[model samples]
Structures are given as structure tokens and as C-alpha cells.
Target: MEYILAKYNYWIYILLMMIGLYAMIAKNNLVKKVIGMSIFQTAIIVFYVSIGAKRGASIPIIAHGHGHDVIATAVSAAEYANPLPHVLMLTAIVVSVGTLGVALAVCLAIYRRYNSLEEDEILEQLR
Candidate 1:
């Protein structure tokens, strides 16, 4: 049961990624595309967080008012979660938000120009 839970989470993330990617590529509406992109980005974040998470580990950090090196000194090595992946995840989250914003803005521009959100309709209008 424990192995199943662990494996299932990974599979769920993979399935979400594939679904989001398919929606992004196969959908006809610009808004739908943006939604798909967001889905895809979120799946990636889930994957990252899952990779960093251990079943019993506590988040890595010194307790309040404790110095940076204090936790390292006080806690046993086995208790703390890895900090590196969490930091990388934070950066990735910011980038994903930026990308999503830009994608939505572009979708809005398309809607304004064509007065429709469908990709096929926009292409038809262009041609």
C-alpha cells in the first residue's frame, strides 16, 4: 500500500502532464490553450514538489529566531527535508506565472483582433 501510494502520485503527475499537453496542442480556442498551458505548468510544479517531498521529513529551516546554521547543528541529518529542490521549485513557479500571464495576454490580443477565440477561426480570418 505504501509503495502504491508513492507510485500513484508520480503516475498522476505524468497523466496530468500528458493531458495538459494534449489539450494545449489539440484544442481550437485561444482561451482553452491558455488553460491547457496553465494545467501543464501546474503539473510540472506538482512533479517538482513531489520529488522534493519525503514521507516523514520536516521542512528544512531553522526555527524562528534561530540562526541559519542552528538547525543544521541541532537536528539530526535524517529529519530535515532537502532544501535545494524547494528553492528551485520557487523559481520555477515564478517563471510559470510569468509565462501564463504572457500567454493569456497574447490570447486576449487574438480575441481583440479577430473577435473570436477559436484558433481555426483566427487562422481563417487571417487568410
Candidate 2:
């Protein structure tokens, strides 16, 4: 029970990721697949951000205009939340948005050409 309580967030994220994966794999509609991809990207971003979280930690930024002696003694690595994961996630978010846009555009083109969003219909049209 204690283990489950402590790691509930991880379990939730895993469940979300699995849902996205299922949607991507099992859905027949192009739009639904695109939405699933977006959900998968979101789950990845959330998981990364969650990995960076620290209990009793402050932001990574340092205050300016404070005395050098005070600053030197007051700041420590343990006191600040990990910033690398956050920064990487920001980049991932931008890339995800761009990818989503491209994916939607492709789906739009597919819809325009075939007049259907269903995978089976598109394959039939292709044949």
C-alpha cells in the first residue's frame, strides 16, 4: 500500500501512455490516430516533468542583487529542482507541436484526396 501510494503518479502516467498507445494502434480513423499521437506526446512531456520534480525544492533560478557571501552559502544543488529535464521537455513540446501540425495537414490532404478519414477506406481508395 505504501509503495502504491508513493508511486501513484508513475502508475497514472503509465496508464495514460498505454491509452494513447492503444488509440494509435487500434483506431481506424486518421483523426483519432492523430489525437492519440498528441496524447502520447503529452504523456511523455508530463512524465519528463514529473521526473524533474523534487520535494522541498525551489526553482533553479538564483536571485540577483543579493550579497555574494549570502548567495554562496544559501544556494545548493539539492535545494533547486532539476532543470535539464524541464528544458528538454520544452524543446520536445515545440517539436511535438510542429509534428502535430504536419500530421494534421497530412490528414487533411488525405481526407481531401480520398473524401474519407477511415484507414480501410483510404487503403481501398489507394488500391
Candidate 3:
């Protein structure tokens, strides 16, 4: 049961990633592509956070009570979630937000020029 639960998290992350990729490829509108990009970014975050979780471990932050948390005392280095992944994820989140902003800005410009958000319509307008 424990093994299954642990693996399930990864499966869910994979499913989310695939769905995001499909949406990105299948959609025609610029806004929908941006939405798919955001979804893809969120799936990556979910994967990172899932890896951070342990079967019985508390959060990495130490509390004042009892010198350190009891759960923290029990884990060895190999079992503990690495802090680097979390830090990298923070950067990924910021980049994703910036990208989303730029995508929206470009989309607005396209809309202003073409008066339609559809990909085919934009292409026609451009030609």
C-alpha cells in the first residue's frame, strides 16, 4: 500500500504533464496555448512537491519545541527531501509567471491588430 501510494503521485504528475502537452499542441488560440503552458508549468510544480513529501515526515522547517521536530530526528539524509529541488522550483515558478505575462501581452497585441483571437484568422490577417 505504501509503495502504491508513493508511485501514484508520480503517475498523477505524468498524467498532468501529458494533458498539458496535448492541450498546447491541439489548441488553436494564442490564449489557449498560454493556458496550456501554465498547465504544463503547474504539472512540473506538482511533480516537485510530490517528490518532497515523505511517508511520515513533517515539513523541512524546524520548530522551536523539543529542540527539533520528532519526525525530523527520524530521517536519514538519503530519505530526506533535497532543498535544492524546492529552490529550483521557486525559480521555475517565477519564470513561468514572466512567460505567461509576455504571452498575454503578445496575444493582446495580436488581437489589436487582427480583431480575432483564432490562430487561422491571425495568419490570414498577417498575410
Candidate 4:
């Protein structure tokens, strides 16, 4: 129980991913599937962010401009957190938004063409 309590974020991320996967795989509506995809992407983003975070850690940047013309403060790497994961996650967020926009546009196009959003209804019309 102590271990589970310490890693509850992981469990929440898993639950969110499962919910998104189920919606994408089991739902009939194209819009719902797109929403599920977004949800899945969000869960992944949160997971990465959570993994990148450390308790009581400061940013990687060092400050040295306080009442001195020379660099006087020195901080080891252990004192700062790595910013790569968070930076990459920012890029991922932009890409996810773009993908969601394109996917919803595609869904809109499908609805216009078939007059429906249900996958089965669209397939029946195609047949």
C-alpha cells in the first residue's frame, strides 16, 4: 500500500490511457474516437511531465548577476533538474494540437460526405 501510494500518478495515467484506448476502440462515433485520441495524448503528456519532475529541485539555469560582475555562484548538476523531457513535451503538445485539429477536420469532412458520424452507418452507406 505504501508503494502504491507513492506511485499513484502512474496508476492514474494508466487508467486515463485505458479509458482513451477503450473509447477509440469501442466507440462508434468518429468524433468520440478523435476525442479519445486527444485524451490518450494528454495522458502521455502528463506521464512524461510527471517523470521529468523532481522533489525540491530548481531549474537548470544558474544565477550570477547579484552585486558582482563576475560569476560567483556555482551549482552542481545534481542541484538542478533536467529540462529535456519537459521541453520535448512542449513540442509534443503543439504537435498533438495540430493532429487533433486535422483529425477533427477529417471527421467534419466525413460527416459532410456521409451525413453521419457513426462508423457503422458510414460503412453501410458505403456498401
Candidate 5:
């Protein structure tokens, strides 16, 4: 119970991932699938960003010193957490949005061509 409560973010991420996967696999609507993909990507991004966080730690910036031994004392990694994962997640978010836009545009094109946005209906029309 303690572990579950302590790691609640993991549970939330897992739940979101499952919901997205279910929508992508079971939902018949193309738009819904795209939305699911976006949700999944968001969950992954959130997981990465959250995991990168350090408790009681400061940012990655090194503390400036007035003495000559600034590099030795100020660069200790024990007090600061790396911010790369969070930065990478920001890039991932941009890419995900662009991908979602392209996916929705493709769904729109398919709807324009078939006059329907449903997977089953499109397959039936193709048959």
C-alpha cells in the first residue's frame, strides 16, 4: 500500500497507456486512434519527465564561486540532477504534436475520399 501510494505516477502512466492502447487497437474510428496515439505519447513524455526529477536536488547549473577552485567544488553532481531527460521530453512533445497534426490530416483526407472516418466502413468500401 505504501509503495502504491508512493509511486502513484507510475500507476497513472500505466492507466493512460492502457487506455491509449485500447483505443488504438479496439476503437474503429480513425480520429479516435489518432487521439489515442497522442495520449500514449503524452503518457510516455510525462513518465520520462517525472522520472528525471530528483527529490531535494537542485538544477543542473553549477554554482559560481569567487575562488579559483570553483570547478572542483561547484561541479559536484550530488546536489544537482541532470535536466537532459526533461529537455528531450520537450522535444518529444513538439514532435508528437506535429505527428498528431499529420495523422489527423491523413484521417481527414481518408474521410474526404471515403465519406467516412470509421475503420470498418473504410475496409468494407475497399472490399
Candidate 6:
């Protein structure tokens, strides 16, 4: 029970990822596939952000006082949340947005060319 409480967020994210994977694999419509891809991307982003979270931690900022001669104190790593994952996730989010835009544009072109968004229909038109 304690383990479950501690790791529930991971489990939820995994469930979301599975749902997205299933939709991408089993759905008939191109739009549904795109939606599933977006969901998968979102799950990844959330997972990364959650990984960076620290209990009883503060933001990664330094506080300054009005004394230049004051002795510098060592900062503990555990007192601050990890910023690397957050930064990487920001970049990932931008890339995911661009990818989704390109995918939707391609879907639009496919729909215009074949007059259908279903994979079977598109394949039939190709053949």
C-alpha cells in the first residue's frame, strides 16, 4: 500500500500511455491516430515533469542579501528541484507541437487527395 501510494502517478501515466498506444494502433481514422500521438506525447511530458519534482524542495533560485562580506553557504542539492528534466521537457513540448502540426498538415493533404481519412480507404485509393 505504501509503495502504491508513492508510485501512483507513474502508474497513471503508464495507463495513459497504453490508452494512447492502443488508439494509435487500433483506430481507423487518421485524426484519431493523431490525437493518440498527442496523448502519448503529453504522457511523456507529464512523466518527465513529475520526475523532476522534489518533496519539500524550493525553486532553483538564489537569494541575495545586502552584505557583500557575508560568508557563502553551501547549497544542498536535495533542497532544489531538478531543472534539467524541466528544460528538456520544454524543448520536447516545442518539438511535439511542431510534429503535431506537420502530422495534421499531412492528414489534411491526404484527405484532400483521397477524400477519406480512414487508413483502409486511403490504401484502396492508392491501389
Q: Give the whole-model CA lDDT for all candidates, comma-separated.
A: 0.82, 0.89, 0.81, 0.88, 0.87, 0.90
Q: How do the residues 1-127 of candidate 3 rate in per-residue lDDT, one tens digit apiece?
A: 8987859978888888988898888899888888988988999998998767666655565444364346465545554556666888989999998999999999999888889889988888778
Clashes of 1: 0
Error of 4 at 77 (Å): 2.9
RMSD (Cα, Å) for all candidates, in order, is 2.5, 2.1, 4.2, 2.3, 2.9, 2.5
Q: Model 4 shows how many backbone clashes?
A: 0
For candidate 2, lDDT tens digit of each residue in 11-120?
Answer: 88898899999999999999899999999888888898889999988887765626656655555778789999999999999999899999999999998999999999
Better of 1 and 2 by lDDT: 2
Best by TM-score: 2
Among all candidates shown, the one with the greatest lDDT: 6
Candidates sorted on lDDT, descending:
6, 2, 4, 5, 1, 3
Q: Please list all clashing residue pairs in model 2, or write none if there are none.
A: none
Error of 2 at 113 (Å): 0.9
Across 1-127, the per-residue lDDT of candidate 5 in tens digits comes to: 9999998888999999999999999999998999899889988987887788787788766667566766565365667776889789889988988998899899989999999999999999999
Expressed as tens digits, the lDDT of each residue in 4-77 for candidate 6 is: 99988899899989999999999999999999999999899889988999998888664553376544776678
C-alpha TM-scores of all predictions:
0.84, 0.88, 0.79, 0.87, 0.83, 0.86
Q: Give per-residue lDDT, candidate 3, residue 101.
A: 91
Better of 3 and 5 by TM-score: 5
In candidate 5, the residue pairs with backbone N, CA or C atoms under 3 Å apart (3 or more residues apart, or in different chains) clash, namely none
Give per-residue lDDT, candidate 3, residue 23: 81
